[model samples]
Target: MSTQYEALKNADLYSTAFRVEPPTELGERKMTPRRPGFFITRSLSGATDAERAALKTATASQAEAPAANQAPDGSAPAPAAEPASTSRLLVPAQWGLVPHWVKSASDGKLRATKLVHVKSDNVGTSTAFRDAWLNNQRCIVPMQAFITDDYRSGGKPKPTRIARVDGLPMGVAGIWARWQDEDGSELLSYAIITINANAHGLMNRYQAPGSEKSMPAILNEGAYDAWLGSSAAKAKEFLRAYPAQKLLANPVEKGRKNPLGI
Candidate 1:
């Protein structure tokens, strides 16, 4: 799995790419599974006028929300929650997803490391992701690029940057969770969804030799809203691999570790 990625740092790209207002505090350019990050989800003002009343009736609805002002650790705040009428909003979150059933923070951390990415076919069956998937806790993770180790050159693994050929931001499909402990403490986190790429022209070259190849389920520009609001039965429709011809991958410089090119 790809354990690190490049977050979107350009303010203007937010509006053009996702049609959401840009957050004042953009997160780290290079994000790891253990670092704090951000994601985009439907504005929690109830999803819609029709769903608002039903939202009140469902005790364990996917509308479960985190604190609007601060994350559980008391850092990485985004813009204030938009009015309940808005369609979508940006949110601050932990890069790794923490299921609500976790017994302790340490256990949650251990699980988080292994759950940085969930396979598209297993989201509904994996214990780590079933609840979130069934409840429709879907989200979009915005990134400039993702870093992976390429071994196709017949040598040691090489870190490569995979991004859109047009240099636009990517809205990768993801699932968010709100884990609340018995003491009332909460942790908001998310995990990226990956699809089988063993047969993909561009993605087939990533990962180690002989290992099953997979890539992030990057969504098309027009499907952002539909993906965030899709239900459990239809969510899989949005988890397809991006077109190979539209993505560009480049090897990182010999000593440059930062994807921001600084």
Candidate 2:
């Protein structure tokens, strides 16, 4: 293995305690509901087709369950019962984007763990992301909020949670790829696209006091279709910082807890 790859293999930069708070109704965001398979770190495998279909139905049912169980007079139905399973509209996926051509499982695993974020400026040329970017293999990573290090305190950067002021899910730009092993098992992975945020009032304060400012490429509501279908040149134009006025941030205590529970 090359020295750079070896260093990445030794470091556990892929592990993140941050949890994305996905919206309850994905349709409200006008996102395409394609059933793309994704891998979660704990699960380590993609969901089967059957599982994906079932999840879709379960999500819809949960949304209408309240009205379905109500009476015409706005009263609760008799004989209260528990749901079969709690539906989760939001999916938890591994953060890294692994290329399809990795030679071995071990090598793929190492790269996937380390390649969590791809810089927007280099997406078209970086060896790690060029293929996916050139092929328009784009994806939307929806999240209500994400955690980052804030350095305004001047001493040491502190962990801060950032979310949209409107409390809607943020559609972060991303790229995905699939890797199949010799046995035919497959792993689908993704990485968030980030861009320079040095000029933004909100994002510029996120990193260490003087370090370069960076933020995820958050897409606007009407830009979803364009992002997934537009030419590479058009897509590149959308990879910019979200408006500072629309964001909110607060300090957070260090822990693995997901503030927005499923």
Candidate 3:
């Protein structure tokens, strides 16, 4: 999943920016999202000078007037009942999907027990994800882009970057939880939600026909309400894939996985 900053950028919000170190791989290179327009060479361990400045501004803004979840679009919504926090939590890619019941890092073993990918086939079932699904643990993973696989049948490996066609960044579906280490330090983790491939989309290009080894669970603007709102029923409906044409895939400079940049 992309970072919150990436999602905001995709939504056309430029003033705010968040930074973090991304993982080395995402299942396959073809599953990678496109390179974001903006990137900083700084490491993810500490905030860069630019990130520190941005954090100061964001912190001040939040302190001045905390958001009330007015709308899922990050805007003030009309009068309604209390709003669920639209606040997003950004964590390291290494820690993905920490279970709520975990008492310690050892307890977090279940993190690996469950598949990182959330399958659409078992929407209401799937013990692996049923709890998170019920508790509305869903979230948007802000990402610059993702890597995808193009398994060359009887050939070599093929990869591609699946980016937003509208020239925007994206926020993919994610589930998160908190875990504590032996020293009592709290840590957060998240996992990207994925779906099966459709007719002939990017998933199909590399994935064999009728393959379930591809595609991320992308939410559309209209469905953002149900997703962020945590309306399990409606969110399930929105989990359906958007038209393949809605996404744009392109070939990127191939080499070792290093810092992300244009």
Please give each candidate's TM-score. 0.82, 0.65, 0.60
Could you tell me the lDDT of residue 69 within candidate 2?
20
Residues 1-262 of candidate 3: C-alpha lDDT, one tens digit per residue: 1211122323223213222223222222112222222221111234446546554543444343332322223222333422222222233333245555666565565554354456666744766566767766666565556656555654654445666676554556656444456685655445566676655455567554345455677655333335656566766655555456667766546674532223
lDDT of 1 by residue, 10-126 (tens): 876665566555666776888887689888876443244533433343223223322222111112222343232335666778999999899999899998988889999999999
Writing each residue's lDDT as its tens digit, candidate 2 over 200-258 gives 87877777666777888877644554566667777897776677878887776656353
Write the candidate numbers in order of decreasing TM-score: 1, 2, 3
Ranking by lDDT: 1, 2, 3
Leading candidate by TM-score: 1
In model 3, the runs with Cα more than 4 Å from the true position are 1-95, 102-114, 152-154, 181-183, 208-210, 255-262
The lDDT, on a scale of 0 to 1, for candidate 2 is 0.56
Question: For residue 89, what is the lDDT in candidate 2?
Answer: 29
TM-score, candidate 3, is 0.60
Worst 10 residues of 2 by lDDT: 1-10
* lDDT score, candidate 1: 0.76
